[model samples]
Target: MTKPVGMEVAVAAAEAVALCNIDVAACYPITPNTHIAEHLADIIADGRIDAEYITVESEHSALSAVMGASGTGARTFTATSSQGLMYMHEILPITPAMRLPVVMGLGNRAVSGPINIWNDHSDIIMQRDSGWLSIFADNGQEAVDMFIQAFKIAEHPDVLLPINVNMDGFQLTHVVEPIVFPTQAQVNKFLPPYKPFASLHPDHPLSMGTLGLPEIYTEAVKARDVATVNAKKVIVQIWQEWEKQFGRKYEPVMTYKTAGAEILILTMGSMGETAEVAVDALRKKGVKVGLLKLKLWRPFPFDEIRKAVRGAKTLVVTDRALSYGGPGGPVCSEIRAALYDQPNRPEIVNYIIGLGGRDVRVEDFMKMIEGAPKAKKSGDAYQIYGVRE
Candidate 1:
């Protein structure tokens, strides 16, 4: 085990990528996410990590370059945030469709309206169905740990898919924390050298990215979807192995003090940490509330989420992203769908908060939990929290 060292989360992530010994990195500058790319570029330039770092003109090109490099059997990486992620949107679904295991770091930021750069899940959640395996890190250590797990999970023989580790933009990315660095040998044992399932080469004479004709396109899409769904098994296996080796456990849906609680708050990304604190404070006040943090985004973690809030009578889902004119927020919509058919499911409510760098304090969370029932009784499916009176 290596000693814990203090550093910015972005810096620690860059170091983790270096340890993985990726073959190439295509990057573009975006707020909050630029630091990770900058640090990686520095390490490569310093001759510390032997990898090709390409500074592309746009996020689209950044992902395109990695797609090409990854097709040639390279362990590829990229980093972006908000608009950069949206710019790369055209190429996101293609990665998993082609089964290229490219690992990316998504600096979670708010989508622009009046234009803002701050910590929010709108950027990543906007691309929820992008066919990539997504994970959220609560803190810097979890950030470090997940990056290592991501490469392994993405490249697993059964799960050849792209993965994204989403950390709160400035909240986690720029914030410094004590991170326990994984030893080089430990990483080597955990993540093996890249052995691609198929590579583009002259001798092989393989046709890569052939047109998906209408005749077989539906089947092609179905195959891609199935592959992603089945990847859950591999994700669980890899995380279990990681827990055995590192003594840090991870789950798709993690619960905090749910026992004997009648109300539960659901959260994603690093916001769960704040929600957990609120749960504790409310518990001390005899509020009988608990918290559930969702770590996995795609493949939706339906079973785990269902299990987490089984006994609760009410569910308040805190969403960092708004669905605008839709029923509720994106995550809340999914939760509703997941619990729709259950006979004894809790009355679910969604409260949208922390959009575009807004702060989510413990008191605010308590207010949401306390007010959701009344809001639900008013026939509103969701309520936006924290609007000025």
Candidate 2:
């Protein structure tokens, strides 16, 4: 017997935290991301859940606190965005290297330069090599579901890595849409209290987070790298389990109506929704085009991407962040790299779209398709979309 549920990212977020029954929540407020933390606090205050709510002074401290708390064998949670995420960059490495399965919600926002508060992938992209299992959500429902999935995958003994569930700042964070929030009993049955395999203790505490010799340092780093690289398979497995229990399906990379398409468009995070509009319009006009939405970014599904993009005539990758001198876009570079080794790989084009929360109309995407033919003639890896001199 399923009960009725509503949207509101804040409420959905609160329900996720409550369902996980997190033992520790160390946080500092930031726009868009603040509501998630606020709602969790309210839920805790009302005696809805018994969890340690640590009001930290800064994002760095917030992550550091979670690093320590999760080290002590407690399931932990936190939320942040943009500058807040940037502030915790230093501690991001520490959380994963120490093998804490802390789940965080990154309400994706544009990193500031001239002072802006819109959404972008810069913040998460900056932490690209930070060794965390990064997952991007296309909507509010994935945002809620991925967090629950993060805990299970991250805490797994085979993949002890921190995970970030990324959602667009104002877009998904503020927008209201119906999301199926799991009951406490279901959540309990799904994700139990995190029992850490390794920890800092006195009786068995040999030495935690100690500096390793140069000979051992590289191996230690590779272990984490291999774990992240292998995480794609684990991610798919976990999603299947999640679907089995909850009756909702998700894949590390989702292909929309691409079974027999000639050209495929790739997108990540929130832009995938906007791309869906373009896909529909193109399909209506008898264009053999489709979409590929990338959900797992950190432990990138390279093999999956290569297989998916095969047989397509042209592949257009729409990125939200620029890589500068590489393909001019982060997602484009990764996709290109993934297909570079394939003999039958399609001609790929990269387009940077929707920066600083810009409105991405379906026509803009149509323009990208119009420009794709010339991209091969020009022989450049990418072209900035919707940019004017």
Which numbered prediction scores highest in lDDT against the true structure?
Answer: 1
TM-score of each: 0.98, 0.97
- The parts of candidate 2 lying over 4 Å away from their true place are 1-4
Candidate 1 lDDT, tens digit per residue, 1-389?
87889899998999999999999999998999989999999999999978899989999999999999999999999999999999999999999989999999989999888699998888998888888899999999999999999999999999999999999999899999999988999999999998999999998979778898999999999898888999988998999999999999999988899998899999998888888888988888999999999888887888888888899999999899888799998888988888888888999888889989999998888898888789779888888889786
| Cα RMSD for candidates in order | 1.0, 1.4
The all-Cα superposition gives candidate 1 an RMSD in Å to the true structure of 1.0
Clashing residue pairs in candidate 1 (N, C-alpha, C atoms within 3 angstroms): none
Q: Model 1 segments beyond 4 Å from truth? A: none
Lowest-lDDT window of 10 residues in candidate 2? Answer: 1-10
